[model samples]
Target: MQRQPIAEAVREDIVNGKELVFVDFDHTLLACNSSELFIAACKPSWLVACIDLVVRRLIPWKLTHVPHWYRLRDYACCALIVLLCPWNVMLWKRGAPDLFRRHESRELAVSLRACDPTRLVIVSFGLQWIIRALLSESSWRDTPLVATPNLAGPAYFSSGKLDIVRAHYPDEVIARAACISDSLDDQDILHAVGKGVLIEPQGDVYRAEEHLYLPLRYTAAAKYARSYVLDQFLFVDVLIVIAATSFGFSTLWQACLFVPPLMLSLMCVYELGYFENDMVAARKEVAPTLTAKVERYRTYPIGFGAWAWALVLGLLGVLLGWHFGALRSETLLVSAACWLAVLAVVRAVFFAYNGTATRWRAFFYPVLQLLKYGSPFVLILASLPGAVLVLSQIMLMWCSYLIYRAGGNNKAFNRDVLRLMMFGLGGVCLAASFRSAPVEGFFPYAITAAWACARVFKAPIMRACKTLRSRPARRSETAL
Candidate 1:
């Protein structure tokens, strides 16, 4: 009644030359719903949302039966998404269209290839250009497709599919033809055809009349893994770590010796954090990316694997650093022990207050990041390490501000700019003190004191800003 290889079903019951084979595009042939993936990839915009709502509400469900109306609606919807959405072109360039072609069923492809390309027709409500682009990548490039075009014309949807099929075949030939679809909406097409295959959303084919069930042989797990890893961008941090260490020391030898294991360990650490982020995303039911599925990140194999790999690689980096004379053995051992202790304490503190502590954790994360990325430099250059650390921290703060501003996070941008101003003012005062001091007379403690006082005052300013924000809220509550 139902089978794995579609070729077996086609050969056993049907005549490829005489009977036409109609395939539904979206969930039947492709692993994912192209429209869903496209919508997920697009950035949120109020204008686009309003347009989408208007279009959906105004377009009568009954109008799908009409040819020109359906075409116009399809064109309008596509244009609204492309023009009104803030990141429309970027979403497409990021391979929104390629999502359809990513996991084409090999067995289905084989079955379609076995049939006459002309007789095997793609009937879908999916946009024609996108479906054609997807098909062009596979052996089904020459296959005939009946789909919704970009311009106003006849478009296939619901019962319109049957009309397209009827136009392609004579009554005698249609009596021997077959239609394969994934939704109940296509039941009319199934009823009209002599034979029908009901493909479940998971891609197991069933005999429409017999109601047979078959096990699915394919899944998108591996594809999800590849896409998820690439999107996280762990390698960029590895490069930054290498550059930070090399720049700090102003020497390539120690950078070269320390970078390999350091890069590996840093990637593992970042990926461990990524696993945590993905776990939170899953718990929140926010699948922001194609691969943000619970099965992709939440299982013991994936979660445990990241932690174990990070620990092992971190230890390996320390050992390699000591062995290569990049760092002293005793120093590496002490640093490893302290690192473990610090991580345990941080985790305990972070979880103790639950969500309330998250803001503090976020603030400190970049500070800890600066220290971690600069650890190699600290080990190599004992002299002026403080100066290097201070300067790097100042640069990191400003760079983070620029990034936050670009992303439109005004709150973070303002906070980071305040921090940068404090650092800049302190640096100028310290430098002035050093310059003003007599060459023969050697007291720079006064300058250092001024710099320390400037840093200490920064906390009060931050607290004042927080207090100011709360004052308005407090007044409103009192009035209520």
Candidate 2:
């Protein structure tokens, strides 16, 4: 979505394989409005108020940081965020049914990965957790992520964002190429880049003072995106493929007696590798010092060991069927269900370790985690983290997701999601313990009830949550 001369300039750098800085998220790089869609998914009420405030000029991006504007920002933001909305769910994913209505805003992330992977870099201002999680699974992982740090107290990172960039990379330095935002808030960071491009929306104009103004006609950009992919886009296509293939295989196997279930389970687990949603990437801004650190840890192994586990599961599933009651439709279904539970466990471990959380997603996440863990681990084969993981997942789905549908707060990972996930874990145990059909059906329900009870019993917002909060710490501005 980089308009006119800026797009042409950046594209030239990308094609030439010259070093360049790519700074954009929404419209310019991404095709969808990631932020608005995410906010709509959870906190629909707050979405309108925030956007309306921006339109009404109740809050302004601080170019000069006038006292009134700061005060207005504080008040408007406070009132708008009566409750903090978690950014974890806002990821740039590849596959999921698009039955839901999508939203549009200035937030875009996928565009960066799609347009140019080699020379392009992300320069955005999204939260670090959301940004990192999205980029970890991205083709753009090779590129650096230089974004505005989180601002949630010592536990969060914010303020001195541009200052930190400058201390690392001085303005006098020449970058191969650069793109800057038109937001007055981006002036400092923009000025630091070599060839800053100003992104002015329709009807908004700024008189140039320090840099050249790059006017991108909005209508032209939109028209271009209709036929062509944006520069940084990465997902959506692959996700559609994943969803279609999985759904198709599931339906095809619906009538089959043995292999279909395992195939479906494999696909579900495979989906875990596709990460969460996101809007923008961190701003690289043509600063090597800034870009270097961001690139180092961008790609975290997604669904860590999904493929290996799926293979092992397939082998075991075939072996079990061939040796025992291979023809039993019930056996295949149960095995598939068990694998589903395993996939959920895999995701649970990811959430525990990486702090990744997705609403309703946690239901299926645990088994995925278990599959990944139990696949290569000889220890799991011996004791069956496989069984334990599956039981735990079912316990959670029946107990947590089905029971306490509206309870967990994602904005802050409290004990609710924990207890809910545990319900799944416990369900797995209970189901395994009881072989009877009546008990199996009831166990999930019972687990759901327990999760709900726990949710109701515990403090809605577990004040003492977040391990990072316990120790007093200081982050020097020079932190990468």
**Roughly what TM-score does model 1 have, to 2 decimal places?**
0.39
TM-score, candidate number 2: 0.29
How far off is residue 133 in model 1, in Å?
A: 1.5
Off by more than 4 A, model 1: 1-11, 15-17, 41-76, 85-98, 152-160, 167-173, 203-480
Q: Can you write out model 2's per-residue Cα lDDT over 1-480, one digit (the tens) per residue?
A: 343443444344444544455555433443332233232233333243344345324434575454334433433343344345443244223211131112111233332333455556565544433345444544455576665444533211234335444444555542445654534555555565666665543221111110110111111122124222321111212111122122223322321333333443343343333221210111211221122222222332223334444545555654554444332344555555555565556545544433333344455544554453233221112112223333443443344443443565433544346544564566567558666653223333533344335553445444455445776788988999
lDDT (Cα atoms) of all candidates against the true structure? 0.51, 0.39
What TM-score, computed on C-alpha atoms, does each candidate reach? 0.39, 0.29
Instruction: Tell me the number of clashing residue pairs for each predicted model.
Output: 0, 59
Model 2 / residue 411 / CA error / Å: 49
Q: Write the per-residue lDDT of candidate 1 for residues 359-393, one digit (tens) a residue.
A: 34445555445544554443443222234334544
Q: Candidate 2 overall Cα lDDT vs. reference?
A: 0.39
The per-prediction CA RMSD against the true structure, in angstroms, equals 17.4, 22.3
